[model samples]
Target: MYFCLFPTWHSKVFRNDVIFIYDKYFFNLWFDLYLKYFFLTSELIILISSLWV
Candidate 1:
């Protein structure tokens, strides 16, 4: 899902010259959100497995 979204996101960033000014900031924000979502999902899975066990 991330891989699929990345191409379009990357293209949008590259296509808009003005956004290039804040590209690093935007990329960092995107990465942080992704990581948060990934970790939350992982923790939920672990918790569920523990409950099952």
Candidate 2:
């Protein structure tokens, strides 16, 4: 389900740009997702640790 959203999202972003630049930016979306997930997970871990303490 998550993967499906990515293609559509990238296509939308690509619509406004040239092919080469658009492909690069579209690929960066995955990196963005990784950073977002990493940040959220780290925050969750910190919150849980504080509660435990």
Candidate 3:
């Protein structure tokens, strides 16, 4: 499972508390980037389609 991999993935192993903190921060940053990229692409698609029509 994805949860099981975290402990061994790092060069220096960390405690679960540390791993959990890392997971939370990584997820939040990735989620924010994904949302911004999704919105920008969607708007561009709409703009292009309208201009083409």
Residue pairs in clash, model 2: none
Off by over 4 Å in 3: 1-15
Highest lDDT against the true fold, candidate: 1
How close is every model to the real structure, measured as TM-score?
0.62, 0.56, 0.70
Model 1: how far is 24 from its true place, Å? 1.1
lDDT value for candidate 1? 0.71
To one decimal, what is the Cα RMSD in angstroms of model 2 from the true structure?
5.6
The full ranking of all candidates by lDDT, starting with the best, is 1, 2, 3
* Residue 29 CA displacement from its true place in model 2, Å: 0.2
Q: Which residue pairs collide in model 3, if any?
A: none
TM-score of structure candidate 1? 0.62
The better-scoring model by TM-score among 1 and 2 is 1
Give the residue spans of candidate 2 off by over 4 A: 1-19
- lDDT string for model 1 (4-36, tens) is 445346546578766554565666777889999
Candidate 1 lDDT score at position 33: 92
